[model samples]
Target: MSDEHEHQHEMPATHEHQMGSSLSMAVAATLHCLTGCAIGEIAGLMIATAAGLGNGWSVVISIGLSFLFGYSLSTLPLVKVGVAPLAALSVVLAADTLSIAAMEVTDNLVMVLVPGAMNAGLVNVVFWVGMMISLTAAFLVAVPVNRWLLSRGKGHALTHEFHGMAAAESGWRRWLPSLPTGALVSVLIAFMLGGLVVSIADEAGWQHSSSAAATTRPAQDNPAALALR
Candidate 1:
């Protein structure tokens, strides 16, 4: 009778602990997705804006890059430990798609709703502020979604199982692998795009300012006019 009572008491504790662990795992997973989304979205936006692309094009590019980066980040860890390409892709798509979609929608909506955000220049304070606010809203919205999915053994729960199995098989070898090549490549590409955008914008801005100065200068101040005089 005492043993039965003890088992019953432990059952509730075990369930509670499992629930807590799942919640923590969900939060971590959501954050990982968010980080990738942020990197991709910001890079795309900067690139488009610097290149003088219209707002519609910028949004399209941003969303596309967000998905690419989010999926890449999600799958990289699985592939590093020798998960098959197709299986890793499937798991990442299943685990991160909804969360990434939710975040992208929330953040983009926020940006659209904020006055001047879409048209704001890369150097504008409004642009940075709007991005910060939108990303925060995205994070807030995604957390609940992730938690709900994880509790039901969906979303990141699927990835967690594979990760656990991999860990068991490889022990610490799982952790010893450097960052996945895909992730490193994605980041590098984003940086290159951002740098290209900055260079283009700087050149354009300088040309515009120089032309404006030339047009506004008094004829008396012009070298050609002075030489003629």
Candidate 2:
């Protein structure tokens, strides 16, 4: 066989990589979406929990804010770069709606399913622990969805073209620093983890306090101590 013929006979198994071929890219997009979702979810749940709202209202409020913040975060960058407000919003709605929906559904389900999580007040350890758990679950659920959409040149892929739009813009928007989506995502992730640590510490301290009480209780006041005797 000629070299040219051999070269032309590339295997069918070989395929070109697509936009979402990078797992890290998908992760970054998901994290970007998650930053907004977490803010809305946590805020809604915190408000609902504090106000003693029912689970239904809590889910409704959270879902509403999830879309609100998700669209706002995605839209603001475009608007700052001189895309018209309505146009920016239209693009964002198309770009982030599905991702937010997937995240919100998964997130709300976790909060609803976890025992006493909904009723747990903002100050309660259960609430913060639950917040961490819900966001983690939502993140896991959304990554795959974003990856699927990106592979087809949809989802966050739509926004990729606008990445550097701010570079050429000059005006009042210049005074408004570009919002760093990745930095914001990192902050939200750290907050969730911090809450998790606090919840764990709170739980451990309560357990230790209970154990200490049991160990040091006066014999006469302790039914268990009397029984052992």
lDDT of 2: 0.81
Q: Flag regions of model 2 displaced more than 4 Å.
A: 1-22, 167-169, 201-229
Which sections of candidate 1 miss by over 4 Å? 1-16, 164-229
TM-score of structure candidate 1: 0.69
Top-TM-score structure, candidate number:
2
How do the predictions measure up, each by TM-score? 0.69, 0.78
Local distance difference test scores for all models: 0.81, 0.81
Against the correct fold, how does model 2 do in TM-score?
A: 0.78
Q: lDDT tens digits, residues 1-229, model 2?
A: 6886766655332333333365677888888888888899888887887788998899899889888988888887887778787998988888888888999889888888888888876656778777778888998999989888888888899988888764436676666555687789778878877876777787899899999888777876979989999
Worst 10-residue lDDT window, candidate 1: 164-173
Q: 33, model 2: CA deviation in Å?
A: 0.6
Residue 226, candidate 1: how far off, in angstroms?
22
